[model samples]
Structures are given as C-alpha cells and as structure tokens.
Target: MKLAIIGAGMIVKDYLTMVSDIPEIKLNAIVGVEQDVPTMQELSEKYGIKKVFTNYEECLKQADIDTVYVALPNFLHYAYAKKALESGKNVICEKPFTLKLSEMRELKKLALDKNLILVEAITNQYLTNYKELKESLKKIGDIKLIECNYSQYSHRYDAFKEGKILPVFDPKKGGGALMDINIYNIHFIVGILGKPKSVKYMANIERGIDTSGMLILDYGNTKVVCIGSKDTSAKIQTTIQGNAGSVIVNGPTNVLSDFDINLNNGFSKHVDDKINDHRMYEEFKKFNELVADHDMDFVKKELDHSESVMEIVDMALRDADIQLG
Candidate 1:
C-alpha cells in the first residue's frame, strides 16, 4: 500500500523506524499545515518519501496513494478520516477515534457507504501477544475480577502546569488522561472481555480535563477496574482473576511484552514474548492485510469495536462530570 501520512508528530518517528523494513508498504508523502512545511519536508527527505504537501486537498489528489494514515491530534481524527474516505482512500486512524460516539458512527457509515476500509490504529488489539492472552483466558475458567493500570507522566504536563495547554492536556483538542493514556487500558480489557453491562469513572480533574481516572466496568458476574493516569506513575500491569487460576501481564497495556499464568494447585508458567520494535509495528501489519484483501467485514468489525470503546468513554466522562471542548 502506498500511504500518505497526515501528521508528523513524535509517534511518526516511531512509525518511520519500522515502516522502512516492511516491503509491502511505501511512504508516498508527508502532509502538514503550511506552517509545518519545513518539518514535513525534512521528514520526507529523511525517510525517502516521494512527495510533500501542505494542503490536504493536494495530497488527497495523489492517485497513486492507496491509504492515508491519520496521525493528527485526537480532535482532527474524525474530520481527516472522513475526508480521506470521501477521497476513496482507506484510512488508519489513531486511537480514541473521536471524542464522541456520534462522530465515530458517522465515520463508520461513510466508510461503509463508500466501500472503503477504516480502522482505529490501536496497538494492543493488533498484537500477537494480546491474542495469546485472549486464548489463555479460557484456561483461567470463570473470570471474576480484572485489574488494569497504565500510568506514566506525560512530558507535556510541565507545559500544562505553566498555563500552556498542549493537546495532551487541552479539552478542546480531546486531551485528557482518559482519551490519551486510559484508552489503552480500556482496549486491552474490552477487546478481550467485550463490552461491560455498565461503566462509570471517577477522575481527578484540573482545568476541566481528567489528569487521572479510575474506570469501573461491571459485567454482572465479573468486575473490572481500569486505572489510567498522566499525573503519576505506576508499575503497569494487567491481571485477570478467575475461579481456577489467574493471568498476569507485565509491561504497559499498549505493549504486551511478558505474562505469567498461575493455577490454583499447579506450577506457574512465565511467558516472555518481548518484541523490540515499537508498538506501531503490529498496527501497520494489520492495516496492510485489510487493504490488500479489501475486507469490508474486517473493517466494519473493527469500526464497531472502536465505536463501543468511544461509547464507554463518553459514559465514563459523564459519570465523572468532565466536559471536553
């Protein structure tokens, strides 16, 4: 697939580090706002990209491009993905597909009506290790409790404290602990367990944004707690407790690195499936398959799952009394 990148942010560097090794995909161009032309051109040159443009319309007019990777800020995802789909290009949008469920629903309908592929670029759901974790769930028997925590202080927090509200901390830009960091924990849980019967959130608010929050998901028989924080740090781990045994996943929820299984009366097993590459690797591989096979079914399923995630997030925000601009 010939891919045009819509943003040149910190994550784009990680994507470039891996895309160079994949033979099936090509970096066709990098596009950004007019003020970011110099940076985009530099990235294009460094990554051997063929073209660079400051206008979205000009970039979308490139007929050779088969897909567009919308890596812009959270708030821009819906608009950019909609335009890309309208332009007949498959879109691989970044996480928290949109701030609201209505926006995601609209994008999903547009992609389907256009017969195009649209996927949320969430790493955990695409990783092989996560699939294995799902397979091991049955071994643990009836699940009763789940605890997931993904917390790391954001680099932009300092600037936020200084009254410079960056995207990571700005409500107007879909910024908050829930949308930025907590979403990973939600994906790891929801992808495996499906949607819960009820959802609620308790968040620490600062300037109308959630800096840290605890999400409680009730599945009737099972209870799950997801902890996400950008104002503090924690030993990131995911634990699935069941009647017969339990499973423990180490490393961040976004990066499924290592895991362990302990049975009630048997020896425990340690699993180490650490991949050195950045989290973007698995997502790109999945996108390639969706584009090559022209699989609308797979695309729709992913979109539906993303929509559910956003629905839960929206409800959680309401429960916590947080409002985004």
Candidate 2:
C-alpha cells in the first residue's frame, strides 16, 4: 500500500522507525502543518519519503498514494479522515476514532459508500499475543473478572499541573485519561467480549479534564475494571480471571507483550508471540494487506468492532459527566 502519512508527531516517528520492516507498505509522502515543515523534511529525508506537503489538500491532490494515515491529535481525526475518504483514499486513523459516536458513524457511512477501507489504528486487537490470549481463554474456564491497568505519569503532566494547557490535557482537544489511555483497555476487552451489557466511568478530574480514570464495564457474567491514568504511575499489568485459572499480562494493554496463564489443575505456562516490538507494526501491516487485497469484509468487521468501542467511549464519557470535543 502506497501511503501518505499526515502527522509529524511522536506516532509518526514511531511509524517511521518500523515502516521499512513492512515490505507491503511504501511511505510515499509525509504531510504536516507549515510549522512542522522542518520535522517533516527531516523525517522525509531519513525515511526516504518521496515528497512532503504542508497542506492536506495539496497532499491529497498531488501525492501518489493510495492510503492516508491520520496520526494527528484525537479531535482532528474525524475531519482529516473525512477529507482523505472524500479524496478517494483509504484511511487509517488513530484511536478514539473520533470525539463523538456520531462523527464515527458519518465516517463509517462515507467509507462504506465509497467502498474504501477506513480503520482505527488500535494496537491490541491486531497483536499476536492478544490473539493467543483470546485462544487461551478457554483453558482458564469461564471468565469471571478482568482488570487492565495502563497508567504512566505523562511527561507533560507537570506542565499541565503548572497551568500550561497542551492538547493532551485539554478537554476541548479530546485529551484525557479515558480517551488517550483507557481506550486501549476498552479495545482489548471489547475485542474479546464484544459490547458490554452496560458501562460506567469514574474519573479524577482536574482543569475540566480527566487526568486519571477507572472505566467499569459490566458484561453480565464477567466484570471488568479498566484503570488508565496520566497523573500517576503504576506497574502496569492486566489479568483475566476465571473459575479454574487466570491469565496475567506482563505489560499494558497496548503492548500485549508477554503473559502467564496459571490454572488450578496444576497447568501453567508463559506465552509471548508478538511479531514486532512496536505495537503499531502489526496493525499497520494488517492495514496494508487488507487495503492491498481490497478485503472489505474483514475491514467491515473491524469497523463494526471500532464502532462498538466508540459507543462505549461515548457512554463512559457521559457516565462521568466529562465533556470533550
């Protein structure tokens, strides 16, 4: 898939680091605002991206690419993805998909109408370890509880504490613990359990945003607590408990790195099956393959899953009375 990347942010840098490893993907161009021209130029030179455009419209009209990766901030996702889809390009947007479920619905409808692939760039659902974990669930018997914690004190938290508001901590920009960090836990759980029976979010709010939060999802037979924080740190771990056994994840939900499954009948083992060190690698690789093959069926399946996740996000935000763009 010939791809035009639409950000010069950290996510773009991470993607640049691993783009070479994915043979099916070609970095045709990089697009950023005029202020980020230098970064774009440096990235383009280093990654061998053939062109760089400061304007999205110019890139859409001029770049020789079939796909656009919307790696911008959360609030920009809908507008940018919509533009790309309207330009007749397949779109791969960063998580949270959009700030609102209604926006997500519009993008979904647009993509389906155009017969173009549009997917949310969530890592866990595409990871090898995540897949293995899903398969190993039966070994643990009926799932009774799940706890996923993905908390790291943000580098910008100190600045925000000092009253310096950046996009990440700015509620108007869709920045908060629930959307930024907890959504991974949401995807990890929802991918396995589909939609929950009900959802609620409890948040630690500061300056009109959620600095940290606990999202509770009720799945009838199973109970889930997803802890996501940007205001504090933790030894990030996730666990799936059942009647006979439990599976413990070694790391956070985003990087489903390694896990241990221990059962009551004296069977236990460690599993580590991730194909790449970078969490974004597997998802982008899958995106490339799907777009290349024009596999709309699989793409639609993922879109449906993403829609469910977005629905839960909206519910969680409403439950907490936290408003975000």
Candidate 3:
C-alpha cells in the first residue's frame, strides 16, 4: 500500500514505530499543517518517505499514493476522508467513523460508488485476541450480561479545567467520552452483540460534553453495560457472562492483550496468542490484504458493521440530548 498519511499526531507517531513490521505498507507521503512541517520532515527522514506536503491538496495529487490515512482530529475526518475517496484513493479513517450516521452513510456510498476501499481504523475488531474471544463465546453458552469499562483520567482534562480547551474536550471538534474513549467499548460490544435492540446513554455532562458516561444497550435477549470515562481512572475490564461460563478480558479493548475463559464446570483457560505487540498491526495487516485484493464484499461487510455502531452512537447522542457541534 502506497500510503499518504494526513496527520502528524500521536497516533501517526505510534504507527511509525511499528510500521517497519508491515513492509508492504510503503510510507509514500505525509501531509500536515505548515506549523508541523519540521516534525513532518523529522518523520520523513526517519520513515524514508520521500514526499511531505503541508498542503493536503498537493499531497492528495501525488500520483504514487494509493491510500490516504485520515488521522486528523474528529471534526476533520468527514471532510478529509471524503476528499480522499473522491480523489479515488482508498481511505483508512481513524475511528468514531464520523460524528453522525448521515455522514457515515454518505461516505460509505461514495466509497462504494467510486470502487474504493474505505475502512474505519478501529483496533479491537481486528485484534487476534478479539477474534479468539468471539470464538470462545460459544464455550460460555448463552450470554446474559455484558459489561465494559474503558476509562483513564485524561491529561487534557487538566487543560480544560484551566479553561484551555483542547480537541478532546471540544464539543464542536466531536470530543467527549463517547467519541474519544468510549467508542472502543462500543465497537468491542457491538461487534460481538451485534446492534442492540435499543440503546440509552446517561452521562456526566460538563461544558456541554460528556466527560464520562454509561451506555445501556438493551439486546432483547441480553443486556450490555458500557462505561467509558475520561474524567476518572479505573482498571479497565470487559466481561461476558453466560449461563454456563464467562469470558474475562483485561486492558483496553483497543489492544486486547489477552483473555481468560472460566466455565461453570471449573474449566479455566488463558489465551495470549497474538499477532504483534503493536495494537494497530493486525488491523493494518488485514487492511492491506483487503486493499490489495480489492475485496469490496469484505470491505462492505466491515463497513456495515461500522455503520451499525455509528447508528447506535447517533441514537446515544440523541437520547442523551447531546449534539456534536
């Protein structure tokens, strides 16, 4: 994949760290703000990328680039990704997909129409442990309750407290517990439970944004409780309880390190077989193959899953009486 990355943020830095492990992903170009040019140059020298453009349009015109990675702030995802797809470049958009289901629908339609691969860069769905967890669900028999907690008191919250608003706390930028950290929980649950029959969100609102929240997903057959908070700290855990057994997952859903399966009959097992140390590796590995094969069928299948998650997000936002500006 001849890639053009459009952000010089922390995520991009992390990608560069393990990018060499995925040799097929060629770092063709990087585009960012002029203010970040120095950092961009630093990255270019380190990654051996030849093209660096402060102007995204110029980078988008690079004939050698095959895919665009939209790693920008939440608000820019829609516009940047749409431009990439319109330019006939496949896109791997960082998660939260979009702020609205309408935006997601339009982007999916555009990608399909253009015969381009558009994928949400959600980590949990692509983790080998996550895949294993899915298969392990059967051993647990009938699932009755699900609970997920992904919370870390953000360093950015201190800036917000001092009246210095950063993107993570900015309502208009689509930052909140739900979009920023909670969506991973959403993906982890929705990916397994499918779309809940109904959803409700009750959040701790501050500055017109949800700093922390509990999302209740009513699946007629089972109930799921998803908790994501940026204003508090806790040991993160995801538990799936079934009549016969239970599955326990520790750590962030994004990088599912390992899981334990405990059955009612005293069958206990630990699973740690993983593809790579970096969380993004598995996703990009699968993404590269999907892109290489031009697998529209598989792409659309994942797109549909992303769409369902977005729909629940939209519903949660509405029911919470919160709107992204």
- Candidate lDDT values, in order: 0.88, 0.94, 0.92
Tell me the TM-score of each prediction against the true structure.
0.97, 0.99, 0.99
Writing each residue's lDDT as its tens digit, candidate 1 over 1-325 gives 8899999887787788889767789888888888887888888888888898888988899646989999999999989999999999999999989988888999999989989998999999988788888888888889999999998988788888889999999999999999999999998888987899999998999999999999999999999999999999988898999999999999788988879999998959887654546677877887898899998888888887898898899899889888775
Candidate 3, residues 1-325, lDDT tens digits: the string is 9899989999999999988998999899999998999999999999898788988887888548989999999999999999999888999999988899999999999999999999999999998899999999999999999989998999999889899889998999999999999899999988888999999999999888999999999999899999999999999999999999999998988889999999999999999879899999989998889878999999999999999999999999998888796
Scored by lDDT, the top model is 2
lDDT of 2 by residue, 237-289 (tens): 99999999999999889898899999999999999998888888898889988
Q: At residue 85, what lDDT does model 3 achieve?
A: 91
* TM value for model 1: 0.97
Clashing pairs in 1: none
In model 2, what is the error at residue 295, expressed in angstroms?
Answer: 0.4
TM-score: which is higher, 1 or 3?
3
RMSD of 3: 0.8
Ranking by lDDT: 2, 3, 1
